[model samples]
Target chain A: MERLILRVTTKLLFAPIILFALYVQFHGDYGPGGGFQAGVIFAVAFILHAFCYGLDETKKAVPQKALTVAMVIGLLFYVGTGVATMLLGANLLGYDSIDPDSTHHAGQHYGILLVEWGVGMCVASTMMTIFYHFTGREPDINQEDW
Target chain B: MSAFEVELTPIVFLDLSLLTMLILVAFAMLRSRHLFAVVMLSGIYSLLSAAFFVSLDAVDVAFTEAAVGAGVSTVLMLAGMLLTARREKPKTPGRAPVALAVVFVTGAALAYATIDMPAFGDPDAPANSYVGQQYVDETPNDIAVPNIVTAVLASYRGFDTMGETMVIFTAGVAVMLLLGLGSARGGREVSDAEPEDGEAK
Candidate 1:
């Protein structure tokens, strides 16, 4: 796991992985990607880091508290959009009133974007949280057991 | 001959080949005794299915299958295997006949059930005819999104997506509760999980 080749490859690949995840997240509107796919892809970059550099190193970079907060924030972001729309006199998640006088298209676009971003945030952190917890466990079997 | 013929178009050939490979991988997974190999085979299964989904023109589902199913799940399973035995424990053969019978009955029942369903992608099929058509027709004007799936998922059915997000959040929380996030190095949970030597007694 500590081979020089693996370490160098991970370092080179990490930023691009995150960049691709972001592309899948925002570019989803015009394409086949979406929040769920983007979130999982984003989580993957961190998982790759943990795989090469060891779990402790990755944890130091992304604190468990930060992931927890991110998980909550993403959910709240989605709900907050709905609340804002509601207060704006639109029904829950109803985007018509978001752009009252003009064409309702812009309203729908913005509403979809807002909610999708929230979903992406929640999914990414939740996945990272799962990966962290799973890998943090003490091994039950020794090398000889394998 | 006419009744037995299926036009072997390139798309049909590609589909048959993919399905054959998928079935082969599944059989390999079933026969493998090594847990690690089985996990790797399962990842292969996911990748094959992702390819199949792309062939079916469901790119978003293919993306998810490739990412979560093949990538993260494989890593997670390997981590899980680290906590358990590398080799699968020998299963007792006493129930093999009953299990085989049950599987055969279930497969036959499912195959029979599909006989009454409309042909694949039929224009008049209930699913293709109703709200699905409306969504496709009205998305440009109503939701104003190019990707109808995105428009429908994020807006037309926003509540459902919120619920799905909450479900993912809940799963993360449940994992944290069961296996606290290694915060303080799982100081208390580690003690609780210590190997019990005399539990059988």
Candidate 2:
């Protein structure tokens, strides 16, 4: 795509989309958005890039191996947090154990934030990986034939 | 004249209009032969449903529906369509009737079930009287989060959310395994060879 307009616009919109996704990821604690939506939004920015530039370019930027690893990392992060809390002397997935020295409020807040981050990471990577697989399929037939 | 009636009136109208539009879209999508049109209509349907969610004050749900249903799902459908036929293959003779019967029966059953549900905004409803009330009332002091929904989802029900995340991860892996990874080289070279520039509208 040699079109100057699309190339420039995609470049301009790319950063802001990721930034907004991060904001939605963190601000979900107080607002209407959360990890799931934020993750999809983040993936959409990359999908837009794929639309504008090309699938191969997008894949280069976000490799399949990396996405798969990130997906596992997110799940592990969530499970690890729970296990850590358990080891700290509370029930599984208990936030109160995260800060045993004081009240549970602060622990709950931090635990929620960490858990949301894990959700966000898993969701974003999964969405992108799915998109990549779908778009990367072999073109067995001509576009016009369909 | 009552405050409750005033609040309910607009919501009733909104729900009716949104449902009407949703039905119309569904009918159009069903009748359409072109897969592209079907996908676009589905996206529109999703957006309209998201609007309905917003009206119900479930902004988190609205956001997810808009992003996942309207945005990502549409693109995925389009990509899938590229691999297959643009026009839907003709349905079998008896399939439509069976599907219609199934849909009608399911819809009827669901509507009938709604009759036993507590009225909207009923404070005494079992749903409200259970953990829902506790989550709402205690979220501020317990979690210090302004968004009770987030507190419930991430902290109160963290185990459930972790399972959901794992489910999604499994889905991604499943898709990857079913479809072998394609070429790593970007499509830029192919596009450069063609005279036509592929610019997204």
lDDT of 2 by residue, B4-24 (tens): 222458787988899999999
What is the lDDT, from 0 to 100, of the residue A10 in candidate 2?
92
Model 1: per-residue lDDT, tens digit, A33-121?
88888999999999989988999999899988899899999999899999989999989988777887756478888888888889999
Model 2 pairs whose backbones collide = A56-B186
TM-score to native of every candidate shown = 0.90, 0.86
Fraction of true contacts retained by every candidate, in order, equals: 0.86, 0.90
- Chain A TM-score, each candidate: 0.92, 0.91
Docking class of 2: medium
DockQ of each model vs. true complex? 0.68, 0.57
Candidate 1 - CAPRI tier? medium
- Distance (Å) between predicted and true CA of A78, model 1? 0.8
Best by TM-score: 1
Q: List model 2 lDDT by residue over A55-137, tens digit each.
A: 88987898887888889898888888899898988988898778756664778877877887888899999998888888888
Show model 1 residue runs off by greater than 4 Å: A141-146, B1-7, B181-201
